[model samples]
Target: MTAETHAVRRGSARSHTVPTATGGGKRRDIQGLRALAVGLVVVFHLLPSLVPGGYIGVDVFFVISGFLITAHLVRELESTGRVRITEFWARRVRRLLPASLLVLAVCVVLTFTVMPAITRPQNFTEIAFASGYVLNWNLAASAVDYLNATNPESLVQHYWSLSVEEQFYLVWPILLTVAVFIAARSRMRAPSTRPLSASVTTRRGVLAALLLVFILSLAFSIYETARSQPSAYFITTTRAWEFALGGLVALVPGLRLSEALRAALSWIALGAIVACAFLFGPGTAFPGSIALIPVIATAILILVGDSRAAFSPQRLAHVAPVQSVGDLSYSIYLWHWPLIVVVAANVSAWPSWVRIPLILVVTYVLAVVTERFVERPFRKPRGAFRRRSVTFGTMAASIGVIVTVTVLATVGIQNAVDQRQDDLQEQLSGGGSSSSECIGAQAVYNDCADPFAYTDLVDPAFAQEDGPWAWFDSELAATACSSATVGSWVERSCAFDGASDDDPQVLLIGDSHADHIASPLQRIAEDRGWALRVETRQACNPFRVAAESDDENAARCASWGADVIAQTVADPDIDVVIVSTRGDSGVWEANAATAFRDLEAAGKSVVVVSDTPNVDGRQVSNGDLITGPACVLAAGSVDDACSWDDERRDTWVEDTAAAEGVPVLDLRSLVCPDGVCHAIVGGLIAFSDENHLSGSYALSLAGWFDRELTPIIDGASARG
Candidate 1:
């Protein structure tokens, strides 16, 4: 989960540097800054312990890009009083699209060939987003979605930073053009003898506008960072302030500073940035008010002006190795991530010492070759290629090719998935389900000749994607009510109709863990002549365990829990209540015990279901951190593929239920047979991803649910 948010583009070698207020050739210090930022990001991804806050390197890149691009655009705006949006876009396309599109194309090929098949659908989906320069928004949405909880980072996830860069390339130029328009109007209205010339008016207007963007975006960044850090981290709105700060530096007039002072300030700012890299970590809430520390320091470093004083930061930046790395930072960033991910997947046993240097060497070589062949040729191309229409056309075609490649690859993968579904279905019809000797729990629990005999199910490539889906609605989920309707009691609550008023009224309530059981419970209701209503919320236990946190989400969950508890108790038609949750803390257990007592006092029958076999979260006896989903994906249902959880889950369930003298529906035998659990049970992918019970596997256990729940339903019917 390292966020390796690499910055995308760099100028070609002929004139790769930006000028200060005082015009100059390539700035070795700026190049050094690129080296520092990329080095931090690369090291963070490779050696996170050494540089946890290295992710802030992306913010540094953001500022560098904003400053460089805004400087280039404003020079034109001040000279001409108008900005050419298409011409600006065409230049960006030439500098970036060739290298980026080539990498994306290569990624498409690797996803089809080298990457794990289970990851292709997601990988290709993100590739499409990256192709459109919208991967940041896609990532922001995914970060907040509970359904995507186990969706691992894709090969091109690092493109999110580049996506933000592309969006800025589009918007910033337009904003500058508008600033020029405002300046032109003001100039026309000014007196003929006015001292403020056209260039001064335009610069003043742009400075004012950029300053507004800085303030508004920084305030929004702070506000949103506190509200939703995950989403805040990737969105353009929250990050625009970083770029605005850089733009302000680009436009602001420079000071006449002594060499010693410039060197002192540059080195200090540079050290502060590197120090912040060490200070931050995965747990840190990013790019909020805290981000201002590094962002402001970067602007100050730029503001002080570039210098090559022997002890200054620029001297270190200009060193042969640093300058070389900075020259290829964009290409290195692109190639290194996919290579590292692929190597880790294929050779996980290799230690970091071996993997890190090997990846960096290979990455540097690739970067050198890509910059030489792909990047240089396309940038500032000759006659026909330099035409704005041709550059635009080439960009469109490159995007089309990537989209086409991804679509074709995805279709082929889907076809294989479809064939897998057919094969599993054929097995089921050929007595996989009827005998109860294979598929799901029976294969393990029953006295079958070979417990793993049937082994008939969709391939892990397809099955790992399975998840609880009862929250979706055609009708009974209520109008405009679905998984998105969480945060309140009145929404996302579904009611399955009963045949008659006298039918036993049952309510299944809790969080996502409760949702996994919906498949079988609905079958139980239909078969046993009972009415069922499934009321589940994301991460919100029926007991409101989040009451301790002051977060808005926690408050919403707390309010929802209180509302459901009272409403379920007040509704006389409700006869039985079933509760299950992941039970994040001991507070949930105490609250569950209290809730059980309340239900019993209301004359309602209650059943407590134990949490699932949790090898995914629990520590192993040998202290190995192997995950069940990962084991299943690699080893299938083979011997020793089965693993044991810490064995505390069953005890917790019993202790919570025993407090109120309620019956605990202990289904450990079905999930973890005799203290051993298989990644795939009864030939079905037992978990959606490591933990959540897959809907398909849950449905396969319908027979067991019927046998066990019949008594509870009969008693509830008698009570009703």
Candidate 2:
């Protein structure tokens, strides 16, 4: 979510939210606030170090919306006895849909043509959600799902805030109508003291409702923020309180503070927003207790600005710089994020000073054109948009454009994936190598010519989808088994194929390296009649002492590691402990050896798999940046495409385990058979994203893995 500053609210002369004009001129105070909010967001996106907490600019807009919309609704309830919900919705469509859809159309062009081909499908999915104005819920689900937690940022990531605002627009007017009904029903029983007394009662009822919303939403925000900050950051429930705070301000517009107090409070509120912009960063837990700083400060500033008297000295918001920016705030907010994202990813060689200014100039220029051409044309009720049917139709048509583009783009992406799959199938059949071994790493052992060669690689999207995290999630989140999970939230079976009490009890446990192989190995366990129990944490090393570290993740790893180690050694039914880790030197080696020695002493058969190659490093040659499957996608089936020469980390776990009387299963030779490694070998893509093997590639190596582990499993089974 990004800057979504609304235009100044035009209220009746006696309205609580009436804009304050300066010296008989139109009010620009709200425009100034919009300018400040959008400026903070743009600066944060461009040069985050300068304004770490500038993300709160979104909260500023939320308060502004709540205040203005609530004021307008309450005014209608007083004067006309009801809100024009249809007109309000039509107006919202006119104001928002035009520029928002324009940006999304541009995003569609970028995703299909200019962006990485491997991730176009994923990008299109996000685009579809953005078009639907539910991108925030999509993002929240992704945030909660550990499988999707590491997804790359999309072009429309900032649209999540707009989605929240759209939802509020949809629900707030209906709620105000409810308050009207409440007032009417109450008046039927008790007599009125004055004319339009029902309106007064309705306002009070609305005020009470807003107060309850503010309190409950704020409390839920704090609770959910602590429980899961990533999900809470985007979900609307965590943000309702900010809007309620603004509504409450609108309800109490006549709290007559002195002119001196208004001036002081406005300046102080502005200062507070600035402080939040500078002080808060990504690490700060948000939309919870911390978000109150900017939300409350923004409400106070709006309250004070609207309350200022005619003779009062012009406030900061009435100034020219702020007013100009606020005038084009919506357009600027829409354009800046996509520009920053694209520029940073593609033109990283440029220094921050050079890039930031260039980005700002381009964004401002685009905003100027959009404000004049796109935004202005839609704001006026003319031609097709004049009819309410046509107004809503225009919204449907705008969304339809995004949907059509996404569909066409996704079809192209799917065709490319299908072509790649077909080409790989042909290559294997055309070859004279062992037909059974013409898959992934097994091709190397079976002496297939140019085993690392390929004419087509597994699509990067498929490679990512090939990770075994889903089964881990099933085991961790589902009811079928008691497998280890991140927070111990649920118990699930980590088995690939089903097993029972009569099967050999084999345990595969480690960090993510073990996980990469778990899917294929699950099949291996089933074929061998072994009860495979798999558990892997992302960064946790399988060590006894849990080498000291300051990172909170490391602390979690330590705790998880300790629990896993104790469980394995204590459980006599566990036939073998298959340990894998990305081992390092120093205390890490010492910890690994100690853990292995203890496992051996407990009479548990132990086998250590070597660490995989260092496939995670970035390839930044000249000005080109190739990541994940980009190298393969660029090279396209060349003999050396997507190959790496690094080989240092291959045996860290193997060597340490061997020293502690643990049998070693070194697969470096299989992965990098000729002292060079390729991401795709024998038509199979290996590493998912530089860290772990694709489940497809891992499953393809079942034969060799089974051979190495059978003797270990057989020994343990005999003992049991």
TM-score of each: 0.91, 0.81
Model 2 / residue 344 / CA error / Å: 4.0
Q: Pick the candidate with the highest TM-score.
A: 1
**Residue-by-residue lDDT tens digits, candidate 2, 442-554:** 77766777676664455666665555443333543354344544541211236443366867878888776776777657667767778778777755675735445533445
Highest lDDT among the candidates is held by which one? 1
Q: Clashes in each model (backbone N, CA, C under 3 Å)?
A: 2, 3
Error of 2 at 88 (Å): 1.2
Residue 162 local lDDT, model 1: 93
- What TM-score does candidate 2 reach? 0.81
lDDT of 1 at 34: 84
lDDT score at residue 203, model 1, on the 0-100 scale:
83
